[model samples]
Target: MRAMAYETYGGTEVLRETRLPLPKVAPGEVLVKVRCAGVNPVDWKIMAGGLDSLMDVVHPVVPSWDVSGTVERLGIDVPEFAVGDEVMAYARKDYVHGGTCAEYVSVPVRALAAKPASLNWAQAAGLPLAGLTAYQLLTRLGTTADDTVLVHGAAGGVGSLGVQLARAQGARVIGTASPRNHDRLRGFGCEPVTYGDGLTERVRALAPDGVTVVADFVGGVLDTTLAVLAEGGRHASIADHTVLGAGGQWMWVRPDSEDLSTLGRLADQGRLTVDVAAMFPLSELAAAFTLSQEGHASGKIVIEV
Candidate 1:
């Protein structure tokens, strides 16, 4: 199989297209023929050793956790899916080794979910990680119709989904983004507020009393989150761990087939959607990584296999 991998942690320059033997499928897992892989900031960050202390690295690491593909074969004891079933997963394992940026990947049954039929390959590929992040954060915060929610970095991959999910739950959403993306957020049924200078005031103008929930995807905005959060309101941050010290949850998305399936149901029901910013061939994964690192993309970047 041809894969984009790196033998050492460094930069996108280290990624090389090379041939590798087929990944061995463990019990309760399935070997998926990759159709597309989603590019997240964590992919490049892992390449740059951002998770060195938290995860053990194996040489020749394949670097993507988001996958949308078809099950080619099932491992022992797997009874949930059949061959040729279209599926997707946030395929993050306990260690950094095999990943989705390849022709094939082995994903556990616990992480696998039927892909949303309404989404194209690119959109399906992009949904797992970012969608799960948004879903888990909103669900954990117990978001409801009466709440006014604030989303930081609302135009980016995860934030964009968070905006939609919050809106789907009937919450009034105020999303932070640049002027260019404000209209995009509005289309998702969110009120857009420009971030940066006076972000708190802008959010406050919309919520008046204060936002009932805050979901921060782009971090570095704890001050604004605190300023606009209503008393006794809830908040969580995926990017900033310091939120733990601020009476807010610092969350990391997990791979749960049930949660992923919920997202798939929402997509199929037309209550959720994924925006793909760009697509690159599998061999051009380095370019995709660079784009994710640059951090300007308003939607998910994907590698089409």
Candidate 2:
């Protein structure tokens, strides 16, 4: 099998395209012949040893967690899928090796879900991590239909999905982004506000009394979030852990088939969509990593296998 892997944690320069043995299908896991893989900030973070404190490292690590592909074979006791079924997963394992940035990946049944039929391979590959982050944050905050929600950094991958999901639930959404992306945010059913000096004041102008929920996708927006949040409203952040000490939830997306499946259903129903900012072939994997690390891409970056 061909894979992009790193022998040591450093930078994208450490990544190489080389032949590796096929990943064995362990119990309760399925082997997926990957059609495409999503490139996320966490991929490069793991590559550079940013997460070494939290996760154990195995040499020759493959770095990606989101995959969309066909099931080629099933492991022992894996009864939820068949050989030809198309599926996707946030396939992070208990350790940091054997990831989705390869021709094949073994995903546990607890993380797998049927891919949304409405999405093509690249789009489906892009949905798992970002979509699940948006979904879980909203669910954790107890968002309701009557709520007025504020989304920080709303034009980026996860924040864009948060804007759509909040609107789908019948909430009025106000999203903060740059002037160029304000129109894009409006298309996602949000009232766009520019993020800058008077971010709190801008949000307040839209929701006079204050917003009912503040979902911060970009870190360092806690001050604005607190300023605009309603007296009894809830708030959470996936990017900032200090939210835990501030009476807000510090969220991390989990490998739950149920949550992933709900996102798939929403995609199938035309309530959710994924935007692909760019695609790369396996050999150009380094370029993809650099783009994701730059933090300026408007949508998900994908690798076509």
List CA RMSD, all candidates: 0.6, 0.8
Q: Which sections of candidate 1 miss by over 4 Å?
A: none
lDDT of 2 by residue, 1-305 (tens): 99999999898899999888999999999999999999989999989999999988887998899999999999999889999999999999989999888999999999999999999999999999999999999988888799999999899999999999999899999999999898888888999999989988888888999999999999998888888999999999988999888789988888889999999999999999999999999889899999988888999999999
TM-scores, one per candidate: 0.99, 0.99
Error of 2 at 155 (Å): 0.6
* Model 2: pairs clashing at backbone N, Cα or C within 3 Å: none
For candidate 2, the lDDT comes to 0.93
Residue 245, candidate 1: alpha-carbon lDDT: 93
Instruction: List, in order, the clash count of every candidate structure.
Output: 0, 0
Candidate 1 per-residue lDDT over residues 152-249, each given as its tens digit:
99999999999999999999999999999988998999999888899888888888899999999998999999999999999999999999999999
